[model samples]
Target: MIQHGLPTIDQAWTAQQLERNLSRVLNTGVCNKVLDALKSPNADFQVIAEMLKGDPYVATRVVGIANMVRRRDGVAIQSIQRAVQVLGLRQVSNLMLSVMLTGPLLSAEGQLPRRKDLWRWVIACGVANNYIASQLGQQTDDNPDHLVGGLILGLGAIVLWAGLGQAYHRVLGARLRPMSLNRREMMDLNVIHTQVSLWTLEAMGCPDVMGEGLRALLAGGRDETYLRYRCVEVLGARIAGLDASDASAWLADGLPRLGIDQKHVENDLGVLRSELRQIGKIFEVDLGSWESQQAFHQKIMVESGQALASLIIDHLTMQESLGISES
Candidate 1:
């Protein structure tokens, strides 16, 4: 049994209990059927495609990935088997496994109010990562591994929802995200959600790279891989409005520190949003909210820019009143 009311939203839970209870629930649906086939010694793309036969949602997404990514020709793939072949065995399995990790949690019985938003965040981050990574010529090991990294970026937040239910909602509902979210989780629950998320994914047999990427982020490493993950996370935060001020600061400061071209990413924003919304359809995520947030952020940026200019004018006028001059 999970602990929805282990404590009130503002209260804490013992770290020991969080671990024991969370471990019990991590053997997710992806751990069965499709994931099992992936773990099989003779795992093949055909075997994975067969496992997806009766599930139109998964099949559609398989073909969607084929059309959305693997195919540069914009030719639509209507056949799952052909989609599987185009995606290759490794790519297909990783995509299916990563998406399913947190996707099913959204539709599970007695979902939290914010689970859908979390789902949107996860998928949007993954898609944006793939888009950015591909644009930068990151091969992602010749697979859509960025999808896994994207899901991993805020995975703990979702897992905390599963472990603590509404109690987790306190953190979810807060404006803080990632490390700030981690701070609140530490303050309230005495457990870090990222650690829990990593444990849960490992228990579920997630890919080695998912663990490595997330761990690197946690350690504050500045390697190339870390920069890529960090950029995707910033994009995720902006899209989800998780930490708007921080994301805005990062945006204003420019992304060169993270090795991204701000102007290039800015130019691609339209196409990126479109592609994300299209991917959202596969998972039933309403990304229209993302657009709403986009408008809100832009408005804030304009207002802030105006305010700063006003401050400068005020300072210059005061200097003139005092008879101050540069020379």
Candidate 2:
């Protein structure tokens, strides 16, 4: 695996400080518009949606969500207006918030052709979380937590990518690709990303549960944290396009503490992987593992890290436009 350069504590602290100063950016137009819609008892849902349309990524996510809702209801939604009518207001508001929070992480760039395979794993995790939760018989109220939870379960990875930035870039270039270290171990050495993420979430006034839960999950073991981590592990492996057998093996030894039934997880792994492949097609992210997957893990780490910074800037700008301050 290639070894990426590790960021010094000072660098990590610098990233944390910069992130702390970003709250002013999050309180802008896009966030306020959504919050405003939520407060509207008789507001025009279409108009609220049109306001959100200013961000292309947000627009695409809302449209996709609207279609997802329509499909769930066995109806055809031909326009944003019709779609919002079908999804209703509260649900739409939640969808918008979810998109806003994650937009930056999802839109980063600089994946080499072969390295692009990692994103498939990320998408797989998202699909697996949704599917696994559904299979577990979660009711409507529980659905939002599960969806957001699944989507952000790998939040630690994003945190590392965003916080470590250039140092992380160097680390990956020096380590993973050069040394062939696996993704999991490579990230653990750079704990700054995780720490900074926890701080960022707290700064944003996210519930203590979200931050604590992420900490425990990333701590890596068979305890409560491990169980939560299971969701991301399964989803991530699937996203990488690994077969269930391979995924099972990877998780079994690496996450024995999770106590989740590997057999049960294996049964649905193929299905989860398939779902991720479909999402990849939708996003134009190729899912196949090229020789790059086996090369150094470090080389591409920087690329991933830098992409996150770009995403943060874009999202902060979006929030600023809405007049909603980050916590």
Candidate 3:
């Protein structure tokens, strides 16, 4: 509607559509059963593992996590039961819930490029958030649940994209031009991804604390419990290839409020980046490749208003507009 031929939907209609989609996904055959099991305090691991074995895609991911845990020892876990044993009951439950929530997007044909990037971003943020939580000595009895909350914080955007389909595709395509996704959503839909994310989390019956943490992050207020975690998410987005200028603003504003010294920011970020790279390997996602880093560096120069940067920006923009390539 604003530009680039993307269709605009009424905000009310978009919300309605998203709710319908979430209901359908949540109430479907195996998914409903899986979600019910995950929410149950007395969920049987053997039953859940058997159910996961039926879904090859979900099973592979479960096995991937197990192997990642044992990667240094070069141990390969083949059976779903064995993988479940390796990951523990709580982790298995969290993984099942995560997979169920993401199943729709992953199953959407012709959206793999975007889906893969979104998955990588979410996982990196989760790992980074965990690192920050550890630094602050915020240990939880259920660490996987805490990590899952961080992983799914950005999921609202993906949920909206899947719910809106071609309408969202147009929005993504427009991202190749001048506008960012948040700005475009604001202009076209009169709402932002964070709002959608909170709605989606609530609809999925996630813990209230998870939604509270996300709300705190978006509001930029200093909640004693969520501030440090939110700062890590901002840093994680930068590490996952968000705009450097945006990250700079987050640091300039949010760091001071969180009582973080400006001098310590760079060293802390370095450690986080190193940790993310290692985590990326375990998760089978490259946090940022050399070429992507170069691209981002050049993009930052353009963002800084360098006179000669326009040509490079235009070239990159054209490539993005014309191709369904990974950023």
lDDT of each: 0.58, 0.47, 0.56
The better candidate by TM-score, 2 or 3, is 3
User: Order of all candidates by lDDT, from best down to worst?
Assistant: 1, 3, 2
Q: Pick the TM-score winner.
A: 1
Better of 1 and 3 by TM-score: 1
Model 3 spans with C-alpha error above 4 angstroms: 1-28, 38-41, 69-74, 109-119, 140-142, 169-181, 218-220, 256-327
Q: TM-score for each prediction?
A: 0.69, 0.60, 0.66
Across 188-240, the per-residue lDDT of candidate 2 in tens digits comes to 46343445545545544455765554677557566755565564655465445
How does candidate 1 score on lDDT? 0.58
Which parts of model 1 have CA positions greater than 4 angstroms off?
Answer: 1-45, 54-57, 70-72, 140-142, 174-179, 221-224, 251-254, 285-327
> Is candidate 1 or 2 superior in lDDT?
1
After TM-score superposition, what is the CA distance of residue 220 in candidate 1 from its true location, in Å? 3.2
